[model samples]
Target: MTTTAAPEARPAERRTAPAAPPPVRRRRRRGDALGRTGPSKYLAHAGVWLYVLLLAAPLYYLVISAFKRNTDIFNQPFSPFTPLTFDNFGLAFSQASLGTAMLNSVYVTLGAELVTLLLAIPASYALARSKGAVGRMVERVFALGFLIPGFAALVPTVLLSISLGLFHTREFLILFLPASALPLTVILLTQAMRAVPAELEESAVLDGAGPLRVLWSVYVPLSVPTLTVVAILNFLSFWNEYFFSLVIIGPDAALRTAQVALPTLSIANAAQYGVLAAGIIITLVPAYLVYAVFADKMESAVLAGALKG
Candidate 1:
């Protein structure tokens, strides 16, 4: 008892909790340095908004015009957002024979895309896997297809169609579109296929896969993104192809594509801006739909291709 009371226990040292290591101010990365400044950030936002407005302007006009009367379209061109009517769409559908025309467009577009892929895939695979200078030379030859102006080839195409006795037939479009699309399609696919590892092909071959099997099993699956990109591009090009469809398919309402049929709406009602706009909008839907379905894939494909390049 005497020992316990011998000395007054010193007051226990008061512990101060460590100040939370100064709320970690993470060092800004060099890539993000430009985004930190207020002025630069605001300027970037302003530029983006300006660009968006520029792009949206025409679309806004198209949509507004589609619902307005011709007089309204002209007089109040960019005013009053009321008094909308769906009459123009009816006029467009009836006058343009849009129902049949859209069907024709769909048929031709899908057919052309299929034919293009059938030819382009094999050609691309060959070129991609070729080791000799001959492949490079052939690819350069294919590139020359771009040099031949589309307008310049129109005459030949017309004559070729006539010579084959396939003039004014949808079948001819199936044949022709693939020819036109082949150069770009083959080039893109070749590049994409080249990006596929040689090991995959070798493994495929060891598994008793032939060239065609290897292409189908190895290359095609890996190149889906690029294939999608090519498909979308070709679809749009073939869809909006007014000049070719008009010339090749002829003005026959039974055969002409939507693009060709759309102008007929204008002919029937020269001053009906709404009808014309409606027809254009109708023609645009399929393209928009295709893009919407595949937009994300398209973006990734483009980024991948760019990085590979």
Candidate 2:
């Protein structure tokens, strides 16, 4: 009777023991989860920083090389930290034809972005709002473009341009470049337009606004971030474009884009690495400047997309 009574009392005491607080239990759980994972937070951050350094090294070299002489660059390749000079820049501007190329690039890229947005906005809105068979078929066809590489269509596009008597012309490039934007622009705009509430569109219609008015007033304002993103993307693509520009507008010095002009720098001024560097940097400036000016818009676009996602 004494042994059985003692065992019963021990069990009761164990059941009454105080458990850990909620916060303590949560902390323990999180720690256990992290332990099961591969790396700690500090180790992960260290790896990321290391990757960034590796990526940035080439950009640093390019910038520094732009200020040094070719001899200095080849002899002391790693000594880009030395004092800077502007002679390479002067040479680059004079020999690289950057002045002419930059103006042409600006015109081409701006026109491309404008035309792309105009075409994409209407198409995307239609696809997003309509659920008809034609709309679905059109959407699938547009999506198919993504699987096809630009290079694959080069010969066909060139042939088509020649047939239309529009080959090797700025008009041809402006029209051609915008077409490339169609697939991505349509996809992005459809997603963005779909996110806008249908009730808002109906309300705008009830308020005595026409379709055009509603698009400009209601949809445009709501879709600004997405539009900005698409415009920026198309702008960069047109600006950096090399192949189409080369093939379409070849031997036409007046129509050569910035990227097309870059290779000519090395060819014309053989062994002048510094001039080549400066020309490359010159090509990059306009894009960077545009990005900097629209930096706020970029941040907002990213944040809005994140929240929507």
| Candidate 2: 10-residue stretch with minimal lDDT | 22-31
Please provide, for model 1 over 232-309, each residue's C-alpha lDDT reduced to its tens digit, 9 standing for 90 to 100: 878888888878788888999899989899888878887778998899999999988987887655554444434422
Q: Which numbered prediction scores highest in lDDT against the true structure?
A: 1
Q: Per-residue lDDT for 170-267 in model 2, tens only?
A: 67888888887788778878878888899999998999999888778887788787888878767777898999888887756788888888889889
Model 2: clashing residue pairs? none
lDDT of 1: 0.82
Residue 76, model 2: lDDT of: 85
lDDT value, candidate 2, whole model: 0.79
Stretches of candidate 1 off by over 4 Å are 1-55, 69-75, 297-309
Model 2 CA lDDT for position 86: 91
- TM-scores, one per candidate: 0.79, 0.79
